[model samples]
Target: MVELVVQKYGGTSLQTTGRMAEAADRIIKETKRGSQVIVVVSAMGRTTDDLTTLAGQVSSCPPAREMDLLLSTGEQVSCALMAMALKAGGVEAEALTGPQAGIITDFSYGDAVIKEVDPEPVRSRLKEGKVVIVSGFQGCPGGHEVATLGRGGSDTTAAVLAGALKADRCEIFTDVDGVYTADPGTITGARKYEQLDYESLSALAELGASVVHPRAAAAAEAWQIPLVVRSSLTEQTGTTILPGTWSSCSFPVIGVTSETGLSSFSLHEGADRREIGREWKNGLCPWKAVQHVKNRLYRIVVRNEEAPHTKSLLSRFGGRPDTGRALVHVIFRSKEGKQKAGSFMRDLPYTQDCFMVETQPHVWSMDVPERHRVNICQALHDRCMEKEAAPISAAH
Candidate 1:
């Protein structure tokens, strides 16, 4: 039996014809190594963003269904172009949209959840000795409806396909080599993790690490699929996410992640909590937080892109919005991690306006001003690394 491999290439890896050709070469090499390859491609660099911008120019608020219909086209372009590149490399390859590949989802338009996937469509192609390239991020419920999974949806598509096909492994090729202790762009001394458990990666991804999507990490965990994160431009080894919790140290803190462009809201007295819940669910909005603080007051954090829709939902219930906020999370390996992080945050004199919350026993979340996001991440990351290195220094 031939081993099956599921590979996902992000926008940066397929930004140009040269890059697309590189991806095609990578896929062809795998076929030569005696493996059946299934390729998942994202829209080329900035295509999705460009499409969104174009929609905004036409309408202040585009209809969700139409937006999905428009966004789904980006992935189709990528899939077709990738197939052409592979063919030019003298390999038999075919392109299929998400629906054509048998990905079924609900009618949520913008952020649809995959209901089921039938791998037979892809398997048939594999049996024909053709490399299959599937458009990621868009699936259909039924006739004439196209729904896009939210940002980073390609990662989820690859993981789900790997599980459905029982592939040997799922490799996610991105611009970065692997998952790091912090965003390397922000923290210059950040360390790259060689291996991470599902729980750790899931926590990091959910908290705002762009390395992997939270749903993808969860699906891989559920299916017990081996997931690897590698660099598309280099041959260096990347991070492997596997089952079981493994730690490199007892310090507990493992990574730091930060997200900007946030709009926060506070639901005060007389707000209809139930109605707000329905709107959130039905609207498919990404709420970063919905925590109850005190005295019937609830704090909600959402991305800036979805703020307009979220604000409209909030206003119906006496809620107020505050933009230019940022969220940073410190992920840890143990419960004790929270206490340590909390103590450190309390003592740090960075910003008095910052508020800390114990989102999870192993996750410390901070709501800070956008201006201080990078500084806070850098400080916390450096402190964690200091603790990590202390033990070795003492032994020496």
Candidate 2:
């Protein structure tokens, strides 16, 4: 039996016709190596952002269903272009939308969850020696209209397909080489991690690492799928994420991650907590319920990008929004214990301005001004992540 591989290319990897051609060549090269390849692609360049801008121009608060319908077109366009590029390169290829490829998701409009995937069509295409190109980030359920997964959702799409198909590997091609000690774009001396466990990567993603999607990391972990994140434009080995355990001695601080464009919403103590909780649970806006509450106020943190929609949803229940907040998290092995971690946090350059601090077994997070995020990240990296730490062996 031929080996099977599921590969996902990010928007930057397929940004231009020339880049698409390069990706096609990569697929064909894999096929020549005796592996059947299934390709999943995200919208090219800033297509999704452009679509959102278009929607915003039409209405400040567009209906979720209609926005999904409009946004889903971006991936479809990428899929079609990729197929064309593959065909032009003399490879038999066919492009498929998520639904056409048998991805069944929940009816959550703008943030659909993939419940199941029927791999028959993809298998048939493979048997016919045709490379299958799939549109990522969009899906449809039995009776509902088109729906989209949230931002960075293409990663989830690829991982889910890989699991359902039981592929040998899932390769995520991005502009960056791999997961690093910090956002390389912001931190000058950030080092690339050659390998990481699913849990570590998931934490980074949740905290604000753009390289890997949190949901995608979770799905891959649940399915026990092997994941390789590499640069599409370079020959770097990238990083591998799989199930394992590591010693604290070898890996102290995995990375420093910060999220800007964050906003906090608070409801008065007397407000209906039950209704607020229900609305938050059922609402489309992405938010994290903060454990710390002060002065009888219930607080939730949301991405600044989604602040408008989140505020709109919260307004129905009388919640107030506070925009322009930021969070910085320093991630490390939990074995270090909270006391040691708390000490590390205290040692950072500036702590007087930090309004809130949360320390977990493996992560230490603090609330700070959006403007100070980059400086904080750099400071944390210089203080913690830059030092040489013992390497921990991963338990297979």
Candidate 3:
């Protein structure tokens, strides 16, 4: 039986006609190696953002259903272009929308969850020696009505398809070569990890690492699928994420990351926390409660981009929200990790300016001014990651 390889090309890899041609050539080379290739593609560079801006211009608050309908087209355009590029290269290929490829999801509109995937059609196409080009991030529920997955959902789409099809491997081609110890854009000394465990990668994504989507990591982990994140522009080896166990005390700090575009809100003690939580869940907004003072206040953090919607929801419960905050986190593993994190925070250049500094078992998170996010991240990376003697690995 021929082996199967599932690959996803990010927006940066398909930003232009030349890039798409290059990507097509890359895929053709893989086919020449005798493996069936299934390609998933995101929108062209900034196309999703451009569409969102256009939608906002038409309406202050567009309906979620219509937004999904609008946003899904971006991926469709990419898929069609990629297929055209492949055909022009003398390769057999067919473009498929999410629904056409049999991706079924819930009716959550802007942030739908994939309920199931039917890969029979895709498999049939592959048997015919045709490369299957799939539009990532959007799916149909009940065989009708377009619904889009949340941000970076194309990653999820690729992972799901790989798992369902029982592919040999899943490759995510993006701008960067691989997952770095810290965001390479922020830290000059940040090094790329040759391999990573699913847990660590998922944590990085959830905390603000933009290399791979968190949901995609979770799906890959759940399916026990092997994933390679690599650069499409070069022949870099890239990073591999899979199941593994490690035990080493020499490595503690793995990476440092920050999330900007944040807003903090304080809910009074008498406010219904349950109701507030429910509202966020129902709206599919990402958030976290950072601190809860004894019968005084509850400090909640949410994405600044979602602040307007969050505020509108909070207003119904008489809650006032404040924006313009950011969070920085240091990821480490050690018996005394919390203490080490606290000491590190105290030594920072602007400890006094921090609104809050808290330590979990393996993470140290601090709330700071939005303007200081990048600086804080760089500082943490310099003091922690760059100076560390050993690479990040779990204690045995």
Compute each candidate's TM-score over C-alphas. Answer: 0.87, 0.87, 0.89
Candidate 3 residues lying further than 4 Å off, grouped into runs, are: 246-250, 266-286, 292-298, 305-322, 357-361, 387-396
Best by lDDT: 1
Question: What is the lDDT, from 0 to 100, of the residue 161 in candidate 3?
Answer: 97
| lDDT of each residue in 1-396, candidate 3, tens digit only | 688999999999999989988999999999999999999999999999999999999999999989999999999999999999999889999999999999999999888999999988898999899999999999998757899998899999999999999989899999999998788886777888877888778878888899999999999998989999999999997988878643343556768888878887766667676666566567566665455465443666777777777677666555676777888888876655556665777688877657553424478888888888888888878777655643333333
Error of 3 at 295 (Å): 6.9
Whichever of 2 and 3 has more TM-score, that candidate is: 3
* Candidate 2 per-residue lDDT over residues 72-171, each given as its tens digit: 9999999999999889988899999999888998988888999999999898998899999999998887765788999998999999999999999999
Clashing pairs in 3: 247-395, 247-396, 248-395, 248-396
In candidate 1, the residue pairs with backbone N, CA or C atoms under 3 Å apart (3 or more residues apart, or in different chains) clash, namely none
Per-candidate alpha-carbon RMSD to the true structure = 4.2, 3.7, 3.3
> In model 3, which range of ten residues has the least summed lDDT?
387-396
